[model samples]
Target: MGLFPTSPPRIIAQHLQLDLSIRNYRTPAALSTQKYADLRNEHTFPPFAALPEELDPDLSYYEMSGFREFKHSRHWCFLAEISKVEWLARLRLVVRDKQGALVPVAFYTDDKGEEFKYRARKGSTVMILYPDQHFFLGGTTGIRLEKESFCKIVTAPLNELMALSDRVGRYSTWQAGGRTCHGCDEKKVVDLQKCAGCGMFWYCDKTCQTTGWQSKGHKRDCKLIRENGLRAMFLTDRDRFEHFIDFLLPEPVTASESTAAAVEKLSALSIGTESGGSRAAEQTAVIVKTPYKIQPIASKGKGMVASTWIPRGTRILSEPPLFRVPRDNPDISAVDDIVVSKVSQLSAEQQRVFFDLTNIHGTEHSTAMGIARTNVLPLGSDSRSGGLFPIASRINHSCRHNAQNTWNDNIGRLTIHALRDIKWGEEITICYLPTVGSYRERQNRLRATFKFTCTCELCSLPCVYSRWESDMRLRKLQKLDAQIPGLLWGDRVEEKTALGLVRSMLDLFREEGIQDASIARAYNDAYQLALTCEDECRAKVFAQRAWEARCVAEGADSPTAVKMKKAVDQREHVKVPELDEDAFEKWLWMEGES
Candidate 1:
């Protein structure tokens, strides 16, 4: 269940996953999650950046998930040769990792595979983003093209980032001013540790230290570590992790010049930008943007306020999530712990902002999970994945929500658009319930899910007079839903029956103060029915009506609006000849088009 004060609106909730839990536990982290960097392995075989495999006893699927979790949050490098390419339904890149293990990397969804047709080739060198969906498990393909700034190809440099990940492994142990094993990557956590000759190098055993001096190259590396004052880096007791080092990819052409040369080479790839802006080819020129401000609400804590007049269909607020969690995962504690770990890595100021957000779980086991549950919005097509949008979350709940919250795939951002015009200074709101129902139903849902009774305009109508009329309309709307299918698909459909249903649904939407995508869709259905009868000019008017409704909710630049615009521009269809407006109505719906 959601942590918000109202039941999730019907439309939005249809795609969300809800897990209900009520428990509190106090568990402090055993180790601090700290700042980490993507460091290049200067020597040796690099650390083991193990991909999850069943036969490997040294690693578990759980640990591999954590390693992937760590890599997905920041910039990561992939080194591989394209072993196979499948371009038909989707872009699937099968590449061999540094270990010579073949892994499948899928990018983008269905129709988008064509955009990067040239890049998906055999034996091509590519640098995929760290967090990309590397479906290492059986059956499923890897990577999805839907994520932001998904990946880029470093055409010139080859295999520079293919080294094993040093970021993982033995990060748990740290000691300063004490002797530690120099030769051991798997040294025990405590006891039996002694220093070698220089008082700088440590080893667990005499034989190990001796071998390290000659065979493991500690002789040269030790002298360099001591002389260069890298002893601190060698130890793990420091309060903070090391900052990121600039490592150029593909061609570390002479290690010395790779820094400057790499940046120049990768400049066209837009390396550091969080998500693409103009880089997204599908986005149209924005007409108006969502505008709102955050302010303290009486007893509600903080709420989003419209800073200016927000027109219907204006994409009011489009923002990336601070972080995300697997939506369908039933384990609440695990998800909450992951969020907490991510928060620990943020700057103190950023941490404060995250901590200050509303928590429906007052003192529940997980404050992190509480805020996430209360504020999380869907990430993709469904609630199986969700991200917490800091600003969008603050837009308080209303039974009669003024805005529509959607996961906009084109921009890869959580977008809130005004479903209805919002006046300047008005408190911006979105519906928590999946759909508006009876007053009692709304009340019960709000109490059960959010633990607060809603006082929304539609929900607060008294049971004596106001509730009756609203409930009556709602029941009728439900009945209409069942009738429309038969009229649309049945062979003996009467034109008047379909027309009556459309008019009633339109009136019901208005009476309920509803502004939704369905309104436009319903009008489009009428246009299609007219088309079935070859009523061209009459269908144009219905098509125009559908387009107007769409413009008010999706804006003129949206894909749906663009498609509607194309239909409106097809003026050639109206050449069939126009009937008088009254006669047109009778012929179109009441009487058959004869």
Candidate 2:
């Protein structure tokens, strides 16, 4: 008992007709007959019987066990439930027949499985027409689906559909004289009310409708019938194969105007302003003048270049992420699945923009995953997530960068500011490395991670002497970064000695021409050391310098810059002798006090 009964009425038989002149067909019970003995011996036997004559006049319903022979130019159909789905090199489905025999179904359409991904879920019934037995490598046999229009998926289990078919055959038949009421079993010529859910089973009044609904098991059957529109699957002439059929077969009625109103109400309630805005809302309200444009470079690919003479501390750009990836998940397959799902939600133009970016990983990863790994930036210094920005991703890497990119929590966007004055036509760049290292070290990391050799200003020093000096300064900065934290809280070191070490770090930063956020961080460290020694005069100067540097690297509205501004304003005014630029530096370092 599948989707059709053993004996269908004449009305259904007239609609479902198949060509019967090709070959003689035998039912499962007639397999041992003398006429088909050789046919059974040559091919594997089918587990299930042939479909009823009213459903398919000449064809037989084959299961997985009977697909042992590969026939050329043969047409067939099978009913199975999807048990598993794989999205690797291709879209492969593991399906189980009624007898619990499992087999793989692979798709080879132009879009692979993308067009059918939404319908390939576990436990859904699939009706594949004209599929062929495919022999895979390593001696495994499976089924292959080549055409997209030849398959259909129903959003229900196989057993439920079979049971619904039996119910439809018994109650939905026309009588010669009149219609019979299902509740009271009386024939009537007068008009009767039909079940709105399934449009079957006439009732005389409300009492009889309720009686049929509750007492006759129509409640469960009506829901399945209405959800899947099961009557069309039984009566339609599918053997003709005029066109493709998708889910919600026979096509649900178009929604009314009231449906659109209800959807608008739900959208307002879920994403309303009273619920506190999201990053998407913040990004919509942001309006900043962009001073850079993306264009092709000589040796490198597309990159951002300054369109105007941007001064230091100018906000170049602010943008939200096109999409984000969670930082905690390590499973590559699961991450790839998530990336595919996120990319599918974008508009057609946005999807084009996302895929147009670079993919250094080549064919090792899927297209979406490869693009994400190449361009995703960390949301914050310590954030557990990363995001891909359409504008920011175009800014290429340089060892000695002219601009700095920072994630601003207050605005919920990534901001780019000029670390130094960027002249017109100058390419805007940012450091991709977590820390500055020697020339050789930076080149090795950039080549291994980004698949490009570095030719930045610092890496191309024009001579061995200049390169050696740059590496020496970077080596000393690394050692001081490691030693400063211990000395700040050490028991044996004096406060003045710690202050001198912080001063030495600043001198190195100036010598290396590092005007990025590292300078702001070093100034803040000096401020902390002076405050610990209770020197209010030096602390105020250090805090003011830190605020200026932070404003230059990150915009004035950045979190660190705001905090430093408050620290400078809250300190008490201290009177001192007037000094020139040369003497102010010595006074700020407490040169005469010790």
Candidate 3:
């Protein structure tokens, strides 16, 4: 609860400046002479060892147990040879430092922090900056590394950097640096070294650089590059996983141009700016014309409103994740910190969107991490990992939602589509609880976890006596979801019975007001059952339903959507001429009864 500064100590930042400059990455000049020099005043982190041990009451018990807390954590840099490092549960790690020191760097998820897998080794020369001291009760004590913290693992001597030219040369941005002329994107420029003032961009000559300063957009970009520590983003190869080795580390990738391009893309994404490639707003605008507008939701701070009536099967929004962390939960604390770092990278408007999100964990945890927990929607099927989409986040929680949210991996964006026709002026919503249950169960889960009592239609029912049908439908839905796997997996199953159960499940979903990704999956199960039984007519119907369900859940462009489309297409010509549509419907469900 007490404040610990996030900024690195002067000594640590200075050390980083030296390492980066010597390695020919983010040079010293670039670090010291930031365009916005006032940014330096933002660091109020005290010198190493400033915070006294007396204030933290539980300090002695932890230190006595060899899990000493580093109260003065900022800029406490150490050139340590790792004697031992263990990957503990929840991503907390314990490492023995060279100076007979043992510290715990607790909590790192597989996002930007995943880089540690390559760095933390038995005998690697690792330099960690701004890690708070931490001591556990059972002799496992070390520094706690936050998401903003970084470590530079010296795989090769600074003198030998030139030897890695072949590998580094592949990164086009590295070769150009600030030397690339902003006016023409040319590296052949003469005297196009660092910009004399900000040290962020380069130009061919005084005239070209001036044109860049005035017209080519470098004038605006130079300020952002200085503030965002974009040089750090530029120097690190996000994909190059070179493990730290004394003998033969993998190819030394000096930098990644892809990361630089991403940073540039973000920098260009100013409010009211023209829409361009891969920008989140532009891509979403393509599908839903003037899709939605953010407005105040009285009790809930803000919510997404249906600007116009959005029809079922419409892909309302498709956008890249504001930030994505690995779906793993080695430690909740470590993952949360990494999420904070990613949020820090968003543009002004993007940050505004993120900060404006509702956090149910108010006053309990870090602001950014809390909002992430409250707003993050699952990105993958297993729901192991997730992402934050501001537009989707605005659609508040309800037990019976008006809209369905899905993560479309093909497009790499979370898509929110109207499950039914969402009328204008209506507040769009998404169900937060995993699966709908009895009224009491839904209420307890939402209240305990999200810290709010849900008053959606299902929860708003007068009493158990009056809402018998709703409760019965919810109970049946829960039971069906549980029994589905066993029903599908059985060797000697009754195909007709399984089909009937699937049909009942769909009916229950409708009765319970459930419009979810699971609906598409349920239809898929029905499609499989009909196909295995050689009921082509029924299979085609189920497949078409699955296709439409997914079109409203996943995007129309997704592979599953395309496959379902084909299933319906393949059956267009294969019709039994003897039976009409109603007769065929009776035939599919009545095979066992007959």
Candidate 4:
């Protein structure tokens, strides 16, 4: 017998100890079931059937099974507080419908963990981690909901989320089918060999291990992956790591800086001016920047738009160092709430500016922390918190985004550009969540971390269409992964072959209207192919695009961006020999556009 004796087996209707819940209850349904099914069919592959442990209580085993199918729009709500600020262990979101049907989403354990969303469609809104009560809505709707509409609401301060940092790992909570080792393609039988120092890559034998270390790019990448804190992220259970990425990472140095310092530095610089340009000249530059605001439009969460008109490919804004904290730094040992409350003592502007910086702390803290936590973007290399851009924060969330933002190390400022066109009043958005994997995986992530059940058109579709999207994604990743080992070994791809594969991926993104991070990697692969063919012009073009995308995804100021820029510049100015066409094609996916 099931909990619902007469109907299908459903989850516990009420709160299960320490469970996560649906915050928004009123999700609107508009499209017909058939249309929704068509849309789902248009993108996803592999129907949604219950995967083994898709939503497990333990922070591990989070991958969605291809077999599970979604039946209806899910409703998740933040629940009432259950314990003291620091020692609180469980998190529960009240799941109820606009019609009052109840579902309880629980993170039921003393073990602290973090959750992350892998895919969210454009136009989906994710609440700030520790949002004020004003944003909660119970139903999945396109319109933002009033906090008052939320019933049986339960939530704790953002400080509580931050206090339990070790327990939260971004993407650490989920597990997937075992991946075949790149070197040997071994399955369950393979022995694990951890990378020295960095401890990220695994090898099956001494020969494969040596090839990975010396010939493959693992030697260089191992250190970088560890330094950026991504090694642990990709290898660990995704759910736990998701929390870490979403909240636990130290606040970015720029985010913690004083407003006085930011103003003072901005005033002292000759940005967008000749060496002796006056402060008036700099002010003019700021005005010019206003029109070039990079609008975010592609993914759910992280929406941004120009306060004014931005031209095509315009360099929108640059950021200066607000603060700098080294990796492995420790938080000040004090009650987070108490420490956060101290911001009230600051001047209003200072308080405002402080909050504008990136932080994982939520409401109930000093007003400053809450505000800062609301608008920060990842700095890529910086393990601390992501940085905050005042102008950029105004953008909104959409799964299908248009603008791209990058941190430029050379100029020491953030830059933004239109990934696609934008009109005035259209909300700009960047995916706050990773835009990868199937629909269900993405929704689970958004609910766990952002506290909203996304009902964006992409997520609201039937299971069949969602599966199409997943299949395409899986194909791209598999193809890309196949090329890594050979390319890193200094091998090459023929131009025609490389072009063909790259074109396929690009075409797929266009079809889905997604701004995939993988596109950047594909561009880089193309650049390598061009280099192999001694096609300087093509190489330069691909490298430039690769650098720009990487800048947006990672910080422009990050080492990766800096290196890519160097390569781009070199491609433009230098010439090199072409490799054997056969070797090149084998090594890189250089299938030309047919």
Candidate 5:
């Protein structure tokens, strides 16, 4: 099909001609004849003269008709002006159609109407494509906009858009035989210079162009046409719809390039980095083969399972957030708006993956917001913001997780490392809790915060005695953890006592089978305590252990791991008598002294 219906040009021109004739015939008898004459003289060319004689043949076109002519079965495309905006439980726009009828336009997108909140203002012209009448539950019929790609908001009013369209049709189309000068109304056989601003209107000379700009409202029209890219949209074919398109739509991606692009964009933010230039670029350069695959677990909806044997200390995955949300925002509506805006910025494929993520919040929040709230991982332990990672989000939670996730600020990505050897087909899991706790405490927190019951291997220990012993060890570890912090920079506790508390926490970690970053953190705490006591030999051993543990949990590239490595390397070497493992442990902890 050609751009717009073949008959629209003739039909619109006839309608304009008839309207002008009627106005002219009634002008002499009216008391406002002189006012009308003055208004007519203000413009050099009549409005109808702006209308083109022909439409482009490359694009498909729909009839330029009123909403009243629309049928429920057929898809319709048209332009309307927003008369009123309703921000209630749902966003609704009351628009004035070409027939002057008020029609409701309701948004049913993933973010509801929040995606269009910026542009859904009174008098803004909305260009809608393939819209169908929606029968509301309240017995009202209105247009439903389900996909963001199917609509665009031109910041100008509807009447102004009509005028712009007319101008674009008249001047933008190329004619081999001759072109009409917009200012002089003279046909030129030779090529005419086009207006530099809009590049739509042609002029025979500089003087004529100036006349067109000042006398024919070309100045305002030129600005609107150039700013909005109105002429390109008119020339481009938009008959086919595929995925959701947004304002200032990016260049189309081929099917072959889309998968890689989506993975790169969704997995990494590529923003400011400490060491690497862009996290996305660094990851792209070193293509780490995925060791896990997303599949359904028995109780969990979807989880990442090992596709191959993943050894301990191996980096499973490193990913950046698809989008980030502020963690401290108390206003639910404001948060929803933020999520909607971020989601709208993603590519169509990335958006689909984002929406497919788990939404534990359910009906309480919008779909986009719910997915964000359910899957967001903190940028760091004490971060003010959290991000949603597409692949990392699919890893299910386990009390006894075989892998650990740490936010590495140096690379600006979340790195996942295997804490234990994961057999082929085994599920790769991560602990979601901030700290290890007793069975009851862990269950309560998981159930309340994540809306799920813990049934991981640790939580499902068959023997009651085993469970009890595990809880006791965890309680002792928590108590030791609390006491170690106070002794860090204070004279409240003796130096030996502070080192002993951290050593006890490490012992409990072994007894409790905690192989995550907590073990590394405990060793670091012990290293700090030894340094405070000016024990270089003991501090070297503690720092080495901290470095090793951190490397296994957060990878060697982690900032904390690098710092621990530096601490271990920078200290002076101390000569001591060669001893066995048991004797070395006693000496490192200074057990024989006191």
Candidate 6:
């Protein structure tokens, strides 16, 4: 798209230095620094021009539209007057379409630039107390207001306005100014004392002052302010309206704001860190843990998308939970008992810290108990404690998971790696379902249980993909049944033969989007095959990967990952003896391949 179209520009002026030429001349089209400076200093807005002949004391003009059907709402336009004196105050006339829906029809402008700049005096001032409860949806259609259209004006004295602000704990005044005007050294020409009646705007001596009061435009703006002020305080008191006003003209998110957001994320996190209030300390570490590379997927939630390609064996992300719990028992019956009993196990000081924590579920309890009951990841192992990890919970689940997660007990961290190259713009999904069945079965389970539809690649596939997924479990079961007898007998299967079977299973599972306990077994089998062949390099890699999957599905502190890690590490240093290297070649190997 081209920048600065003929239409009203969204881009604002960069430099806020007041136009020095405006200091001497008092033109209706141009704004003077004095007027703007006064409006800003006093925290008042430009006036509303139209006034009702008979004032209704009971009624206030400001009202939130489309309250119950918020989905249909648009921008919250605060309407008021633009006066003759204010050289820079711009106005946009909003109108409803044929369907009577409110929309921005025309904008008022003082300058030719895309952005409007002012000292604050000419700008209308009104505080919205409960902005969160209201949303402004202004468009090309809806309840419309025309440019400089006269609306019934109501007046509030300076003390009343200040009183309203105080009722909401606002000590410092609130005013609207151009984003660039901050810290500007420009001097004001008009005295604010002139516009006390409207509580917005200013004027110099009569030569310049009369131009504002009559020819320049303050007369029109004065009426607009009265209407807007009454509207701002209508029905709801001024205190509740500050939040709304704040939302309409929000403070820019600076470096400090970003830092604050990061701190909030850290404070709420429950994994890895021992300290509870270590937001400053954890920020750098937390930011670093996020993957250096992130691929966009067809995300349905917030932003637009584009795509990128992926390569095999890329380390996607490595994360540590904000908090973690080791569950030894899996039975749900004893879960409450385990949660309660485990709290007492911590040291006295640790106990105090643990109880002070907040649960992700928003329950009232000690931090340890809240995390344990609400955010635990179920690792399928003998020790069934669901370990609570905060960062991990943000990752939503999908039937077809592109990345694999594992918990490292030694490091007490969670690591994730891409199994195969993933394309950008593909939604990253973990399998939420315990198991996959036919299409209908998967969909029903996802919606009823997880409360979201299964829109993963596998779920969206054609008949071929669907059929392959449907038969996967049967094939896995058959393989398991056939292998049981041999493993029971401790038959040393031929190295090549066993490796081929495991590789075949792994490939098939990837195609069918099968992420389950079976993948772990196949990985284990591959590791064993590498060990038998004395391929130390390959064995170490496979063992580690398998060990991670085992930990994620089961638990890091569980016996499985620990045992696998030990075996892999020990094998790394030990030299495998070359005794009867071909002896097992006769046991499981057929008279064929390898």
* Top candidate by lDDT: 5
In model 2, where do residues sit more than 4 Å from their true spots? 1-289, 572-577
Q: Each model's TM-score?
A: 0.47, 0.51, 0.49, 0.39, 0.51, 0.34
* Residue range 295-398, candidate 4, lDDT tens digits: 44444434454443332233444455343222233543332343355555656885575654444456545545455445556565454545546665655544
Model 1 Cα displacement at 479 (Å)?
2.1
For candidate 5, lDDT tens digit of each residue in 103-183? 788775546677787778898988664443444423466676655655777788988877766665555544555666888
Task: State the local distance difference test value for candidate 4.
Answer: 0.40
Which 10 successive residues of model 5 have the least lDDT summed?
10-19
What's model 6's lDDT at 63? 30
lDDT by residue for model 1 (1-594), tens: 111110000001001111111111111233223222223432211212443221122222122222212111122334566787654224667777556667676554324455555655666655442222333212353443333233444332234222212312222234342233556655454554434323334467777778778886556544543332222222222122112212121211133446555345435433443224312211211112235668998877789886554545566776777887788888877887888887777788877888888887777757877887877877754567888787787888888888877665555677677786555567888887776777788889988888888887787776668878988887787788678777877886566668778778878989988787768877887877676666676577677768767755655545566677677668545653334434555655666543
Candidate 3: regions farther than 4 A off? 1-289, 570-573, 576-578
Mark the regions of model 5 whose C-alpha exceeds 4 Å error after superposition.
1-288
TM-score of the candidate numbered 5? 0.51
Error of 3 at 372 (Å): 1.5
lDDT value, residue 146 of candidate 6: 18
How far does residue 14 in candidate 1 sit from its true spot (Å)? Answer: 48
Candidate 6 accuracy as TM-score? 0.34
Candidate 2 lDDT over residue span 415-493, tens digit each: 8888775655789999999899999999999999999999999999999999999999999999998887787677654
Candidate 3 residue 455 Cα shift, in angstroms, is 0.6
Q: Name the lDDT of candidate 3.
A: 0.56
Q: lDDT of each prediction vs. the true structure?
A: 0.54, 0.65, 0.56, 0.40, 0.67, 0.39
Residue-by-residue lDDT tens digits, candidate 3, 514-562: 7777789998998887777777867876887788677666556677888
Clashes of each: 23, 0, 13, 142, 2, 80
